[model samples]
Target: MKFEHVILGLLSWRPFSGYELAKHLEVEGRFLKNKVHLSQIYRLLSRMVDSGWVSYQVSVNDGRPDSKIYRLTASGEQVLRDWVTGPYEPSTRFQDPEFMVRFTFGGPLDHDALLRLIRTELECRRAQVARFRTRDRTITDLDPIEGVDTAMVDRVRELSHLHGAASIDAWIDWLQRMLTELGGTVPSTG
Candidate 1:
């Protein structure tokens, strides 16, 4: 997902200046991987305005320079909705920005869509767990060669894989709990 979309999602809730958007992303949205700077925000806002996705008005302050207050346009809202409703590919092996951004703005998504997203993520986490376990086994199964400390090598290698598996397990557990919290059924899948 582009930073443009993130900005649009943030603006979908309310209007904000470039500085304000940057501040919010830096502070409130610090959890997200993609960080937006003030200059980047201003640049994207300009591009969005040109693409008719957003409109802005300059607000003059008593002593400060004029600030451009940006609002998501009707087209922008539609774009955000379309992106949210779009299919999420489950094949990625790493963290997905689409998931992060979509989940962050999930308040606008329908109940069914939200449930589907969580289920899909759960499936992905299950796949990741399997992959990590396989890798861990491969590392542990390596034979010790002459003058090589294979035991230490295996331990070090398994450390990262183990951590990854544990993290995925935690995420899966959280997702399951989320299902119960939402009064949704956990899908019957391995």
Candidate 2:
């Protein structure tokens, strides 16, 4: 899914400033591939406003600069609903960067080439889980602080890493099984 959809999904929950939206992405139970900065959010918000998918209000807070709070419009809600209910079209352009990289190098890469890519991805995910576990362990060793929600954040990160790792493992297994069923070989590169 596009970042646009994710932004819309957040707005669907409630109106928020661009900064607030970035925070929600950081803290919420969503898989964050990277830390989203406020500038990126504001750029997307601007495009969304121009597209009439979202509306915003500029208001001043006491002791603060003017902020634009954004909300999804009816049209935006319809667009989101349509996206959710629409037929799935696998978008090569939208594929993850690693996947795209493999595809770009796949001219002479045959079935075994694809399987190797999957295996490599699985290994990367395993390393990711290890890193996340280490981070979680480090967090656990910290002394508790009042009003700090470190534990909750750690739990979210742990689960996200675990789930993501499990998913990659599952895909790896499925691909290996399929390769085996296909006589342990993919079509030869011509």
Candidate 3:
């Protein structure tokens, strides 16, 4: 989902400045993975205001520069609700760097598509580790330390890949075990 929807959802609760939004996200656990930095939040809010999805009012406090307090417009509310309830549309390609970064950082995302994505990533990583192990064995047999630096680099990469695979495996196992202990699968009703 776009950051705009997240902004709108937060604003739906009440008006807030960019700083306030960042704090809310920290406490509310909505942007755990894509933790919005102060500057990024302000930039997104500025763009949202320009798009008419949100409106802001500049308020000066004490002697500091004016802060823009933002609120979602009626159209923004509608857009947010529609997005929440609308049919899913799989994007051909994701261009957002934050999205990629969040996935890498073990984002606390709990959606069907996210589950599928994690599963796919786990499989890919497992395959990668297998390939690396094979290559490591081959290199070890052929002139063991002929290229010590290159061998060390390969070993490091293999270890990293193995660590990632193990982490994902543990995550999947924990999630499944939790679901089973809960007596069933995750609820379809959001």
Residue pairs clashing, model 2 = none
TM-scores of the candidates in the order shown: 0.86, 0.48, 0.51
Greater TM-score among 1 and 3 belongs to 1
lDDT of each structure? 0.78, 0.62, 0.59
In TM-score terms, candidate 3 sits at 0.51
- What is the RMSD, in Å, between candidate 1 and the native fold over all Cα? 3.0
Residue 102 miss distance in model 3 (angstroms): 11
The residue-level lDDT of candidate 1 at 145 comes to 73
Candidate 1: C-alpha lDDT: 0.78
lDDT tens readout by residue for model 3, 119-141: 44334444444555345333444
lDDT for each residue of candidate 2 in 32-111, tens digit (9 for 90 to 100): 32578879989999999999999999988899788899999999877765554433333222225334333222312345
Residue-wise lDDT of candidate 1 within 46-141, one digit each (tens)? 999999999999899988899989998999988888877778775465456677777778646556777777788888777767665664266435
